[model samples]
Target: MTEQDPQIVYVVDDDAAMRDSIAELVDSVGMRAETYPSAQAFLDVCKPRHPCCLVLDVRMPGMSGLTLLERLQTQGAPIPVILLTSHGDVPMAVDSMKGGAFDFVQKPYREQALLDCIQAALSLDRDRQNQRETGHRLDQCVSTLTSRERDVFDQMLAGSTSKEIARALDISPRTAEVHRRNVLRKFKVHSTKALIALFAPAPAATQRAS
Candidate 1:
């Protein structure tokens, strides 16, 4: 198995002791962590990166954790965030979940439970990173297709047979078959089903007019 980069866990809280304790707990589990005294502090230093998640205190002196979460969402940043809350803050934390927080841990939390939440957040980040890389690769593959091949691929995806594709593109049926084979080869998919699975989001309008 390839070794993954260490997961970075950001701890943003107003209480210095809470930050220290959370950072220590995270470090004990072999993950990297950084402590921020306030949400603004986290925002000032946060350069978004993959395989990372945030542990944010719900109540902070400046820019509450929930506000920070809202900012992150507005910016379209993909980092997973786990909220930390006191007993009285459970209602707010529940609202944060509805707003896209991965999970929340109540204060006086079980160390094991927090660690499990961190692991889950890290897994989400990894899965998202993998999906982005796959999409980039697929885009590169599509870029390699010739115009005629793209036409054939799109027509095939739109449920057109080889003969229909030929009629649509004003090409011979054999030529349409050749283009179809090239499309499959370029995409590294053996069948139309596999091709569609990979590129289903591609627009149907890409098919040539008959």
Candidate 2:
């Protein structure tokens, strides 16, 4: 399914009634809900990875809510989190915000407030996916440069000596200098690191000097 498909709002709370209530609340509004008793359980089967949000309780037995958030952040899990904490755990909510969680709501929150936060989280996740797609596309475009230019680019990114590159390519050092400049100009990067970093996750170099 596309990113615009119904998002899986994984609500993980050790409290069975609370989890069921949340699932019902979201389902009432025609959204998908997946309930998990623990953080590890959610991580196991949360898939078809489009857009997703997590509503995690603050105090779970195995892994606390904030601990789950940290794990997700470290793993680069793209799903935004809206943590749920008890009144005494408000400090944990603040920490969650600092760790890139979309929002955290204290329990007994109004139903509409939770809904609004979920909407915002889904929108933000969609935006992040779009940016990643655009960046990947730009990286692909960089792969279309000529073979000589590609060599120059890789070397420049590695901070290679222009003289060394010229010797390797059997081209004049002055000529290699021109290629180095061309690589920078093509990628619109002032430095070799920028050029290489751009293509790091993209398509393999085209190497087509045609």
Candidate 3:
């Protein structure tokens, strides 16, 4: 990660001791940590520019961890959350997973186990960040296309031959070929197949093992 936006692990728990311990563990691994006493505090100031994950206690006083997770989901926040739960909160933790939490760790958890979950969450965030950046760049490239060029680009993606595109658009084959080349050049790809691959959505991330 770049210094301008370093990796971060955010800990949100009402228990001050638990918050401090998690912060220390995150720092020990050379990543930055930010601790909050409640979900509201975290929501008030959290604006993460880097790849990051949240470690949230399931039963905070004001706004519970699960509530916060649902709020984030509604806002389309992309940060992965790992819920911290007690033994009795297992059902809620499982529900959180179905609600799109990255993972959950039971209280009295082993240090290495939590660390493993943090690392996995961070990795997923990084992949998401990269995908967003790539999509933005592709959007810029698409914006540079002329209306005719965009039509040609769409046809190419739809597996239309240059001659077929010309007939569809009522343009000469030579003009259609020129537009095709321009589309390929703008996308920095040499062939239509490569262009299609470039525009393909990334595979969904694998679920974490239980």
* Model 3 alpha-carbon miss at residue 166, Å: 2.2
User: Which lDDT tens digits does candidate 2 get at residues 40-155?
Assistant: 78777766365778889988998888888888889877678788978888876776677767777878878998898887777776666766877876777568678888877767
Candidate ranking under lDDT, highest first, comes to 3, 1, 2
Candidate 1, 9-67: lDDT as tens digits: 99998889988999999999899998889989888877866688999988877798999
List the lowest-lDDT window of 10 residues for candidate 2.
201-210
The prediction achieving the highest lDDT against the true structure is 3
TM-score of every model? 0.87, 0.67, 0.93
Q: Which one wins on TM-score?
A: 3
Between the candidate structures 1 and 2, which one is better when assessed by TM-score?
1
Lowest-scoring 10 consecutive residues by lDDT in candidate 1?
201-210
> Which parts of model 3 are misplaced by more than 4 Å?
1-5
Candidate 3 local lDDT, 188-210, one digit each (tens): 99999999999887999864865
Better of 2 and 3 by lDDT: 3
**Pairs of residues at least 3 apart in sequence or in different chains that clash in candidate 2:** none
Which lDDT value does model 3 have at 129?
88
Higher-lDDT candidate of 1 and 3: 3
Each model's C-alpha lDDT? 0.84, 0.78, 0.91
